[model samples]
Target: MRKLLVTLVLILTGTAAYLWFEPEDNPDALQTDQELLPDYVAENITRTLYNEEGYRADSVTAVRLEHFELLGFTQFEQPVYTLFNEAFQPSWKASSKYAIWFPQDKIILEQQVVIESLLQNELVERIETDTLEMLFPDNRLQNNQPVYIQGKGFYIEGIGLQADLTEKTLQLVQHQKTVYRNED
Candidate 1:
């Protein structure tokens, strides 16, 4: 009984001391700080990236892009990305509802991520996922969500994928199913 009483007294005394020494925050100052937070915003942004050969490597158009000055990088809406081949032709295209891009050419596309191959004289395909991570310049695209691929006379379902857009190679990972037509 005595030990319990002593413990309670100590806790009460410590809490009282903290309350007495705590610094007070000015509500007006807090509001002003929030108001003063700087941000950079833009609409209809078109960014084109080039390769070492001075050719157009990639192009991106966004409906709205905004970033906070204090926060470095930020949120983008309706980002459509296109990649080019060595012949300076469109190789593939991608788009997403939203994305967050880092400085190192890393982009995380969220919500209704779509990728399509645009190689000439080849079977066209469309790949869909809930989320995808793309590394530019390196031309690497990966996804960790369920990926659905559809093309003429065929359909493929997979859990993940790793693709090299530079080399035009794709490797699907985990729980994959493919259906192709014979047509022979």
Candidate 2:
């Protein structure tokens, strides 16, 4: 009789534990007002967050959570050309492989990254390691990867480049070997 009583107590305890700890379902799951939104989308629907132009990729991959945060990606493009900005104003063009966008931490361009800027009568050419990080507010470039650059009046090959097109200055990284040749 004692053994039976102990067994009954154990069964009751187990049932009580399951009732107490089991995950509960939301009774109000269908409420539309409770839905989560992306930060980019939540701020402004009329104001665009990111823009692109003349963009083409051999393959395009994208990831976003239900909340609309960019997560991860990998892509390939042939003869890729693009302009990235809130309005897609400035441009980047290349004949062969062009640019990449990493959605994780920042936008990163990878693999045979070539960029050209054509402004008025001047031209700028840049070739570097496949990685480049975008600077949003200033519309500039911040990259630590090895870079080779050729502009209207000079050529530069170095490791790391911070280019401010508005300033007309291409910041070359120090310590790494740098070669610059002025042409006319």
Candidate 3:
């Protein structure tokens, strides 16, 4: 009976010492200081912006959004942004697999970016790129990656792109090829 008690006491002491000296396995501790955690996260979020004239200027929809207020940026997954003209009519629709929006009216779209014109009269119907940078209010788009643009009867492929949505102007930095089709 004494040996049994001694054995049980030794086992209990060993367990207590192991527990006290064991390194913490906390997941939070593995995160580094450079890692910027999101302050808020939302799923299936839709955000709208209004112009000074109280007209719908733009709207953004995302499958998942993560906002880092302190970092002054928001990360989005599968984001679609719709831009409206002065008449409150949707003029362009931009979509990407991922995007990062800054507070300075700049948005960086990455991974299979597509910008499509909603206006039937627009000469440029669609633009596709691997990455793009957009400046809102000014409605300017700049991209250094390869760009593919499709118009009414012509299609253009280039290395870089600069576009002004308001002015309806598009210029390719390094034009690779242009093909025109005649319906008639």
Candidate 4:
């Protein structure tokens, strides 16, 4: 009985010493070191932005959105973006399967991006590409991927595109093909 008690005491002392010397896994430190998580998440959200003049500039709707404030970016799934003209009328509409918006007035749209002109009698009615980048304050659309543009009576395919919605100008880096149909 005496030997058993001594051995038990020794085991207890060993356990206590081991526990006291072991490193602690601080939960707070672990969390801080982990990858950044979304600050907020929403479903079926619509948000509109206005210019300094209080005129509507752009609007975006998404099936799902995740905003990472710390990362200064927002991610969207199935997003549709609309750009308004100086008169506060919708001018261009863009849609994509996925998109990322930065606070620096930039948006990157990916996966089957389609930009359509809403203004009447526009030379280009629609533009399609796999990816597109939009820069605000200038209303520019740029991409290095293949692009397809459709107009009233003609359609054009190209390798790259640079368009200015404000100036109503479009330039294709490499023209692939063009087709025209007679309305008559």
Candidate 5:
């Protein structure tokens, strides 16, 4: 009789707890508006990136850099990323007002990003865009914004662009128009 009475008390307490408590649908719900601020910050950062050949392929200088652990990304202000050629000279220059480096070696430069090729290549010398996605190691750049390319006494405007810095190629994906001016 005592054991039966204890079991009944246990059952009643368990049911009462179950009725009063409920688990949250998401205990660690991600807050989209809440940003993981940088725990460590730096100023005037000069970071160099190496290629597969273990050579200094590119370098970036930023006025400020911040790393966000929860967001899993890094932010840069006034960044200048310069790519070097075989001669160790600056071949391409990419600068932006603001930039973010995400996981997997991808970079997004926003706010008036300008990419310039100093190789004296007639293909594409300068490209201006509001934002660009730069996949390092592959030396690839892409954007869906309006692009302006000027080089070799030729100017062109395009809606979208995909460029291979290593191959020295530029393809305007949409709304391409050659805006030529007579030097004569």
Candidate 6:
């Protein structure tokens, strides 16, 4: 029994020593590799600044950040602007009344929104319901709420829309809408 106990103690002590100071196997063995997430998203977002200047326009809008990455040494921040004409003169200025943020997978904007553009001799107006949904990566936007768009001689209203801002194209289904003169 004494011999058996001595052998067991020797084996346990040797094992502990090996584990405690085994030269750490490989220095890199203790290192862990980091990976970035597939994608990210945000909702209910609003950005405010004194002004934004582009080549030919200065404007402001309700900005939304969607599908971003914050890993490694890279920063992922995408701002989606929703308002009146995104293309305005360098002298354009306005205030945002509503905005929203969405995940890269799902984004919804709903509430009172308005956009106005001032050109040489006219103003373009676009009104949208507070409710909007956008899908990232592909940049698909669906506006199911009511919308009102007013141009030089056109006024449109309805529901059900598929808009691709990247393409600057809007397809909407107008319901019980009326267009007439602009007293403004």
Query: What does each candidate score in C-alpha RMSD?
Result: 8.3, 9.4, 3.8, 3.3, 7.2, 9.9
Per-residue lDDT tens digits of candidate 3, residues 86-114? 78999999999999999999999999999
TM-scores for all predictions: 0.75, 0.45, 0.81, 0.82, 0.77, 0.41
Per-residue error for 122 in candidate 4, Å, reads: 0.3
- Candidate 5 wrong stretches, greater than 4 Å: 1-35, 52-54
The segments of candidate 6 whose C-alpha lies over 4 angstroms from its true place after superposition are 1-100, 115-124, 135-140, 182-184
lDDT computed for candidate 6? 0.49
Error of 4 at 170 (Å): 0.6
Error of 3 at 37 (Å): 1.5
- Which consecutive 10 residues in model 6 have the weakest lDDT in total? 70-79
Query: Total clashing residue pairs per candidate?
Result: 0, 4, 0, 0, 0, 8
Highest TM-score scorer? 4
TM-score of 3: 0.81
Per-residue C-alpha lDDT of model 5 across residues 1-184, encoded as one tens digit per residue: 9999999999999999997896755635545434655868999999997768888899999999999877889999999999998777789999999999998889999999999887775567789999999997888999999998988777888898888888877788886788756742
lDDT of each: 0.85, 0.51, 0.93, 0.93, 0.87, 0.49
Q: Could you tell me which 10 consecutive residues in candidate 2 have the lowest summed lDDT? A: 57-66
Candidate 5 lowest-lDDT run of ten: 27-36
lDDT of 4 by residue, 1-184 (tens): 9999999999999999999999999987777655378888999999998889898999999999998876789999999999999889999999999999999889999999999999999999999999999998799999999999999999999999999999999999999989888632
Q: Residues 142-182, candidate 1: write the lDDT tens digits.
A: 98789988778887888988988777677788857878876
* Residue-level lDDT for 167 in candidate 1: 73
| TM-score of predicted structure 2 | 0.45
Which order, best to worst by TM-score? 4, 3, 5, 1, 2, 6
Off by over 4 Å in 3: 1-35, 182-184
What is the C-alpha lDDT profile of model 6 across 24-129, one tens digit per residue? Answer: 4454443322133325444445544332553322222333333324332212133334333344333222222333343334445445444343345443345456
Candidate 5 steric clashes: 0
Show pairs that collide, candidate 3: none
